[model samples]
Target chain A: MSTLRTEEMTLNMGPQHPSTHGVLRFIVRADGEVMREAIPDVGYLHRSIEKIAEKVGYHGFMPYTDRVDYVCAMFTNQGWGMASEKLANIQVPKRGEYCRAIATEFNRLASHLLSVGTMGMDIGAMTPFTHAIREREMINDLIEELCGARLTFNYMRIGGVAWDLPPGWREKALAYLDHFEPILDEYNALISYNKIYIERLANVGIISADEAVNYNLVGPNLRGSGIKWDIRKDLPYSVYSEFDFDVPVGKGEWGKLGDAMDRYMVRIRELKESVKILRQALKQIPAGPVLAKVPRNFKPPAGECQIRVESARGDMGWYAVSDGTGYPWRVHVRTGSFAAMGIIQKLSQGLMIADLVTLIASLDVIAPEIDR
Target chain B: MEAARIYQRIKDRFGEHVLEISDHQPDPFIVIDPASIEEVGSFMRSDPELALDCLSNESGVDYKDRIEVVYHLFSYSKRHGAVLKVKLPRENPTVATLENIWKSANWMEREIFDLLGVIFEGHSDLRRILMPEDWPGFPLRKDFVEPTEYHGISTVRESPIIRLDPKKK
Candidate 1:
């Protein structure tokens, strides 16, 4: 049979589409099933968050950071807190640091559950998402008890957390982890190794380690590319160094290294690590006042610093500049999802239309983070 | 591979291009000439001793008189990082693009351009990434004023609590 010449087509995905994750829009130039390029047109969710930081003083800005990435708000909260603390040279009490870590790890667990559960739902597996959310709901209850808010828990303050773990909350969190760990194994058997899911994700959207580094991919995305770097383990921010937990990297067991499945597996394995860290943190949390003696009208000296937190998405960088005043001169957040979105145009070339969803889900690009 | 050593290496390699270095600050930053940014960036990334492979964070801050572009460089192999800043004229803040040296600089440069109005010369696709194409001014700039409306939609809303108060009326 003679070959047929097909015309190129331009298609728009999202700005409203569910699979685009949040308010992201992509302009895809495709020749049949293979995409020539998927140019991402972001900013639909731009709330001028960094600008808001300037308007709100250092202490008041804690709640605004929660909206930066609501899925993983703790890291944003912690990143802002750490940056301000570093700028002001304030030492968080040891007990306050442990509380921050405890609340943060639980937030990590909740964020990853939503990510993987949605990964399954985006790829046509509905049952796994419900199962994942069911587990996530328990985590929400635990976090809600700790901070009072479920989605946007503004838990961390500049020097420390808003409050200590509530009475009997430590035991409740430990019990939840004990119940949550087995569900992870059952989740793996249900969706992770399924033949169809593997075929959809394993070999698609492969990002080599060099490209991953060049693009500055952080957290699980960087580890999924087999770089073996995690800001928490390597840099030891907050109370992370005192805890005993292992960092997981993608092994490329099923397909090519740095493929979609590699990223997915990295998140799944990190969930276990979060559990391990939570177990250690709950048992070793020191007793003292969680809130430090920060003045009501706080002002740091004139200086600027960038602090990196290994958030659920990856490494979230908070670049805060203070001009020896009540208001911050400038604040910029360098987010993982922002960098991940940058590489999509290059990765989308020659990828199948359906596989585009797989690539995005695997990367776990949250829209608010990108637009912020 | 401490940050000061990394700064000293760059200072030695490009003496005239290095403008100033402040060690007193909590996080020391070396200011580089806007013209020689690409060269300094290339040297930092390729130099074996200062193998700063990743452009981890890039942001722009408007200081009213001048605009500053900050690049947070990290070395995964050497396990060290350095902060580089470029000061440009406030009127037309233009600097050489480091996108070619570091692929991650591509979107970050675009973001700086969009929010702070810094021009990255030779950037392949220098378009707004966060704001609308027709957005009036750089929202992050210190002198910027939020427009009253955009495309006929009001940007601000009256406080409902104030509106509902009978005593105020």
Candidate 2:
């Protein structure tokens, strides 16, 4: 008997596919139905914001940071603010810190909602996505109230914030939080624990805890692997230490630890944690001026420092080098998605072609964050 | 596990491979010889007491005559972190790849190579990450000139606002 000859076939996922998150292309080599390898081809959305940082002055570059991760612009805003503050040796007042924390926590929730909803959609469920967007709409309104814009919220400054909370915005945000808490359960009931959803996600794209550490996985993806490491808790910055909240790690809930389901579950758990932090920030927020009296010609000392913030995605770090001039010498945004994109190709091998979508959703590798 | 003590341990262990320590900054960094960076990196990851498991961030900065590749390492088990700097001449700044030591360094080193033109020896896939393959001069270099065109398309943005400006000289 003679065996049939077979060859590995190449497939391009997309720089335009809706499911691949943003503009990202994956050149996947497949052996029949199983993926032999998937080489990621990025740089489609490379804005070269780092180069722009050198050209633009410190204060002027805050808007550019917004585009770094539009889904979680607040985190990048905070990251840039914290980095510049450290570079300039400026301290934000307690109230200012609280305000920043409150805004950031809310942004985290908004981002996670999108991720959770979209992950549901990616795996074939659609109702949960709309449910998530409904709740997220309220959060966006509150965020827009805090910052002038909703998506690219350039709300943070070198020392503090761009604006104080609008009148009764705290009351409105608190009400939204109260209304939003039970929506999680409703959404879970709707699709999270659906048999099909579990079957689709569970035991697929399993990354060991050690592999997660090796790959420098961050955010829910790392926590889903049962690592129990969060920059907010482990390396606390801002007033994160002041507030008490649990860092939820994957405990092999539905399948093996660090499976696609575990990653999804971690995001669900984080939504509650983010709310807890927001509550503390809002209640303890003291009344004071929001923006610090930064100099017009914003020149930081000639030094470099690494500032990391627990963004919705992961440890969003900004490494800035200043040259005692208005312009930054060098700025590098170390995004969580960048590493995720690199590691995806290795993880995609030997898996079914369809599981690739599940893996991308679970990892939450948004294209702007990776490309920027 | 303070920065000073970590610096001392690495210096003692590696001897001359540990070139110098810059302790002035809040996050002190120890400069490592380019030749021994790969060895030092592997040791840093395996050493139980100093298990720098995660490569937090790897960035490159071009400083006219020299290009500095900075590696910020964080140990999850130890809960301590350290920074290592490997400086090289502006021309052909090639350092051994950390991709073997930390899987996270794969894309990061590619990024540094793309922007700053620092060649990482033994990098499994050392290619442009955020820039096109045949793109001219490294954009991050202080002396890099912006391309006039990319694939026959004008890279210049002839701004309508600038053209409409009455204050134009």
Candidate 3:
């Protein structure tokens, strides 16, 4: 036998690849099946959304916020609305806050379903995706009835929500939640505990709790790393304080504590928590006006404020500065996906090339969310 | 810890570096000298009482007169947060990188660099995170003028309403 020489090769994974979930690219350095590093080359979907906020007045920016993270648009809407409300010191009516919470929790369910479903699909299980999407489509229909649009539901406003819950909508939402609760077990049976899926994700791309917090991971991602911090629970934002729900953290049942499977399981567990929140919100929602009264030209005092919302992906931070003008002086959205993407190159070291998809899906890094 | 108490601690530690504290109605912030940001960041992160472990949000604003970089520091252990700002001259806004103290600042500084043209000295990987590498100017800057065209591709599209004007036809 003769000795052979080899060199690492470079490969481009996306920019338009099926497993990426959105327009994301990865410059992968590979030696055979294992990767040396997978550097994320993002911003393919950059839409200058933050700049647009400076041009459009505060109220006009609500619709645009929905596009920030279409998978869980309600949180983005709530984040922007909360930021503006904080800047102006406008109090959202109790009913309106309930509406916001109800709509956002439903959005979280839809988002987690898509995430878990896509994780299965990314790992080569196709049937579970159809099942998850089937449940998600129903949520879409319910949200569409609450707000005209489904994906980009601009259901929130600076003071409160755009409208009150539609006629008999609470009963319909409750019915949907009732039907959706049992489906979690079905999903688990189908995919979550599948032998091959566990083999693929277990003990892969483990991020310690300290690393998660140091990287500024939020929402489910932080929980996945065994950090029991949820913006809704610990920070106590909006009606989240009023609603009773459990915050689920990953236990590493089948793998290392902070591995991909742990992240996947955290999202699955959160789907249940979201259902619980929705149940409480729908049952306990008080009767009153949803939209608060405000002047046509809405401009807050010259001040800076930031609002944190527990979006499906993670903790979404919206920092706004108003120079006492019709339009905001500056608006910046520090999204979870952007922070998640930052850690990919570090995590991708020494992983199988195929497992890169697993890493990205586990983090649930949506493109628009990263770019915005 | 309360923001005012945190300010007092920082002031006691770094007297000259702490420029001013605006005890505003909501979200009071401490303005620190750009030169001492890294020192303050490390102090805020390591000090047990002020264990601001997570850099929750970092953003840059073009105030026309000056460029301000805002850091929203949060502590998961203590469950409290503080806002810090560094005002740099508009012409060449530069600040020391906080990436060493808080890993989250790596990408955030790059974003500030990309969008606002603020330089983060000693950043390990300082490149455009959102905009293209060769984009003309920082789009987030207040006085930035969008290029009429990029790479010979027209940035502007003719409005259909303008094209459909009967008077022009």
Candidate 4:
């Protein structure tokens, strides 16, 4: 059978498009509407933070970690803090562990709410986005009470946390948790189960478990593909072993095991687990020093270390090489969003233009994390 | 499969090809010759017991005399990790690509090539992932200096000179 030859149309999705997240551009080769290939163009936000690690001493680099991934800055803060601690062999106190865990869980809650709500908005629903933002504001307030800033919290310290909980902050955080647990249900009713939402997300942007693992997908994306991998539960860190929590993986509730809906559902289920972890941390936290007393000229022995953190995105790895000096010899941050970038061109091969947006939203690839 | 065991297994399998195995400060690692990286990666990916299916992170470090490439590999099934390192001469830092073994290494290798200037021998598309393709010199190297300007845009920031504001002074 003879067929007509057609040229693929070139479409640019922006270093400025609202949907591509931040500064991420995709040049898609499309045959009419279906994308033949969508090669991603990243690095718009690269500030050379790793190079800065050489100039700035260990402590001076804390705030920069927040910029590495601001959506869930607390985790990156903790990641860097812990990496430094590992390098120096500093032991964080019991109270410090509880504070780090509690703050981290709250940050996780805020990050997931934004991810879910924004995905909803990206899929044509707007109300859920507002609802998600409303709940997130409460978290912002709670975090601000603990640390001064709201969005970029350089809260975690090298040995401990930057600040101790303010007077009555615990009571307020517990109240917010009580209020927040019920909001997850409201989120489900308002947008999670909507017919249009399900149809738009379900069975789209499928990533097989093997592909997920092979791609080095971290956090929920790998778990969403039914691979039971989580640094928090698997390779326990920061008193996480003491707490009881469930690791949620995609069971293909609406479609195949690793579809857009599966990844979305994984984040939704994570909200419940985060709340559970928060409640336990709040109850178990004991009174002690918040900041560990590290020396002024802190120099870790010459060595190389790789610290993995379960941030909002998949595995966030901080690799640091110290040469028995105050400054790190070399610092490299390998983020989940960076790994996820490899899959976009593969996933976008046969998807419609609209489906591509859904895939981007479902993957939850943030710009700064990938470009850092 | 602890890191020590994994190192031992790799040492046993590859004998003289293994350069040095050490349990340094925090983690255990095995330094291997750069030429056998692809083959080692293949066995690591296909082996059931030591199924290192995930290439967590690949980093290139620059010392004065030599360049070091570090590969952090993890096995989901076995719940184990191994750090594979290769030391290359500073003149021509080239290591065989493991992109075929772990698809994730595709962009990661490119990034190292872009920022650190380590050449990945068989990377499918080894181009700049972070910096512009034509960007001058690898910025991560210790000896690299910041350019004064780029495309007429000033790259240096004015030093914060002690100045008295007319109103404050």
TM-score, first chain, each model: 0.98, 0.98, 0.99, 0.98
Model 2 lDDT, residue A178, Cα: 91
Candidates' chain B TM-scores in the order shown: 0.95, 0.93, 0.94, 0.94
Model 3 docking category: high
Clashing pairs in 3: none
Per-model TM-score on C-alpha atoms? 0.98, 0.98, 0.98, 0.98
Docking class for candidate 4 = high
Alpha-carbon runs more than 4 Å astray in model 2? A1-3, B162-169
Please write out the lDDT profile of model 2 over residues A168-261, one tens digit for every residue: 9888888888999998888888887899999999998999989998998988888999988899999999888899999999988899999999
Per-model lDDT: 0.92, 0.90, 0.92, 0.91
Report the C-alpha lDDT of model 4 over A50-128, residue by residue, as the tens digit: 9988989999999999999999999999999989999999999889989999999999999999999899888788889
Model 1: TM-score for chain B? 0.95
Write one digit per residue (lDDT tens) for candidate 1, span B1-169.
Answer: 8788888888898998899987957789999988899989999899899889999999999999899999999999999999999999989899989999999999999999999888889999999988889999888888898998999999999877744667774
For each candidate, the DockQ is 0.88, 0.79, 0.85, 0.89
Q: i-RMS values of the candidates, in order? A: 0.9, 0.9, 0.7, 0.7
Candidate 4 residue spans exceeding 4 A from truth: A1-5, B160-162, B165-169
Q: Residue B154 in candidate 1 has what lDDT?
A: 98
